[model samples]
Target chain A: MFGLIGRMRASPGKRDELVALLLDGTEAMPGCLSYVVARDPVDADTIWITEVWTDEQSHKASLDLPRVQATIAKARPIIAGFDSQTRTEPVGGVGL
Target chain B: MFGLIGRMRASPGKRDELVALLLDGTEAMPGCLSYVVARDPVDADTIWITEVWTDEQSHKASLDLPRVQATIAKARPIIAGFDSQTRTEPVGGVGL
Candidate 1:
C-alpha cells in the first residue's frame, strides 16, 4: 500500500474551512482504502492529511480526476502553504 | 483520538536499519490503535511514522514506557533529523 502524510497550513483563520473542503467528495475514489483529514492539535493553522491507497499510481491518477481537480482548485485559495509532505509504503495495519 | 504524523530522516544509507529499530517492540503499547512505519518513496532517507492512540495522554505516556524509551534510545543514533512533526485529532475512521 502507498501512504501519504502531508501537513497543510491554512490562512490564519481558515483551518476549519480547509479541512471541510479536503473531506468533501474524497470518498468513492478508485483504489483508495482510507482518507483521513484531521485537525492538528498543536498547530491551530495546520491540518494533517493521512491517506492510504492501493498503489502509488492510483494516487497519482486521482489527481487528474475532475472532482479532485476541482477540489484542489477550491482549496488553493485558503491554503497558506505546505509545511511538509512525505510519501511512504504502508506494509500493513489494522485498517488495511 | 490522537494522531501523530512524523517524518524521521536517517543518516545516509541507514534508512532500513532505522525502520527496523522503530518497528521492533512497538506492539503491546497501551491505547495504541494503529502504528504504521513506512518508507518514503520520494526521499531515500526518510521514514514516515503514522500513529493513532486512544488519546493525547496515552501517546504522551507511551514515550515514558521502558520499552518505548529503550527503542527511542536505540533509534536516536541513526536518526538524522525530523523533517516534520504534527499533532492531529482523528475524528473517526474505518480502523478505529
Candidate 2:
C-alpha cells in the first residue's frame, strides 16, 4: 500500500486553477488510484492533496510520464512548498 | 483497494476538538491504512478527511467498534454533514 499526503500552498490568485489542473492530472495518471484536491475553507490559497498509488514502483514510474512532469512544472511557481510524507502499509496488515 | 473520502463540518467552536478526536481515532483503527485530517485555511469550521482501509469488510467492521461508534455519536452534532464517496479499484489496477 503506497500513499502520500501533500500540503500545498497556492499563489494568492491562482489556487482555483491549480486545483483544476491537479484534478485533471489525476484523471490522466495511469497508476493513480485516488487523487483528491481540497481547499482551506478560510484560506483559499491553501491546498490539500490525498494521493494513493498501486505500489512504490508504480508511483515512482508515474513521475516519468511527460504529462505528469509537465503538470508539475506548471505548478512549481504557484506552489508554496510541497510538504508531503510518503508511507506504506506493511504487507499482510490489511488488504495487502 | 478500498477507500473512502469523507467531508466533515465542525460546529462553530468545535472544529479543533473534532480534529483531535479523529486523529486519535485513526491511531486506534485496526484496518486503517491512512487516516488524514485537513483544515480549510479560511473557514476554520471546515474539515477534510482522507481515509483508506484494507478492504470494505474491515471498513464495515470499524464502524461497529465501540470506540468508533462512540466517536461517531460524539461527533454527530458537531458534524455539519458527511459528504463522502465510497469507491474501489478494480482488481489488477496497479498494486492490486
Candidate 3:
C-alpha cells in the first residue's frame, strides 16, 4: 500500500483557493484511490491530506499528471509550508 | 483546537489488544471530541490515531487516567514503534 500523509499551511487569505484546487484536481486522477483534505476546525490555513494510491508507480504518475502539476504551480506562494511522509505496509493484519 | 496526529506500530502480535484499549479508554475521556483509530488498509503493523481534545490539560489528564496508563503499561513491547506529534490551531476556516 502507498500513502501520503502530510500537512499544508496555506498563505494568508488563500486556504479556500488551495482547497478548491485540491478538490477539483484530485477528481482528474484515475490513479488516485482515496484523497481526503481535512482542514483544522480551529485553524483555517492548515490543511491535512490523507492520500492513497494503488502503488508506488501510481503515486509517482499521479504527481506527474498535468492537473496535479498545474495545481502545484497555482499553489506556490499561497502555501506557507508543505511537508509529507510516505510509507508502504503489507496487506492484512494478524495481531489481535 | 488541540489534536494528536500520530502513528502507532503495534507489536507483531498485539494490534487488536491496543486497539481495544484505545476504543475502551477513549469513551471515558470527557474532554475528547473525536477519537478515530485507522489501520493502514495495506499495513497491518501500522495504526493511525486522530484524536481531538478540549485542551492540553485534558490531553495530559487523559493519559494519566488509570485505564489509559494501564493500557500503555500492558502495551509496551507489544508495540513495535510509537511516535507522535502535537499541534494547536485556532478554530473556523476563512480561506475558500
Best by lDDT: 1
Candidate that beats the other on TM-score, 2 or 3, i.e. the better one: 3
What's chain A's TM-score in each predicted model? 0.95, 0.80, 0.82
* Pick by DockQ: 1 or 2, better one: 1
Q: Fraction of true inter-chain Cα contacts (below 8 Å) kept per model?
A: 0.50, 0.05, 0.03
Model 1 chain B poorest 10 in a row by lDDT: B87-96
lDDT by residue for model 1 (B1-96), tens: 888888789999999888887777476788987787888887889888888888989889888999889989998898999988767897654344
Better of 1 and 2 by lDDT: 1
Query: How are the candidates ranked when ordered by lDDT, highest leading?
Result: 1, 3, 2
lDDT of 2 at A93: 20
lDDT of 3 at B33: 57
Candidate 3 at residue A75, lDDT?
A: 78
In TM-score terms, candidate 1 sits at 0.72
**lDDT score of model 2?**
0.62
What lDDT would candidate 1 get against the real structure? 0.81
Per-residue alpha-carbon lDDT of candidate 3 for residues A10-45, written as tens digits (9 for 90 to 100): 887788878777776666575555455666566778
lDDT of 2 by residue, A37-90 (tens): 666555657765666665768778888888778888887888876655434321
| B-chain TM-scores per prediction | 0.95, 0.79, 0.81
- Candidate 1 error regions (>4 Å): A9-14, A28-30, A61-84, A92-95
How do the residues B37-61 of candidate 2 rate in per-residue lDDT, one tens digit apiece? 6665556677656666667788899
Model 1 chain A: which ten-residue window has the lowest total lDDT? A87-96
Model 3 Cα displacement at A81 (Å)? 1.3
RMSD per model, one decimal: 3.5, 10.9, 7.2
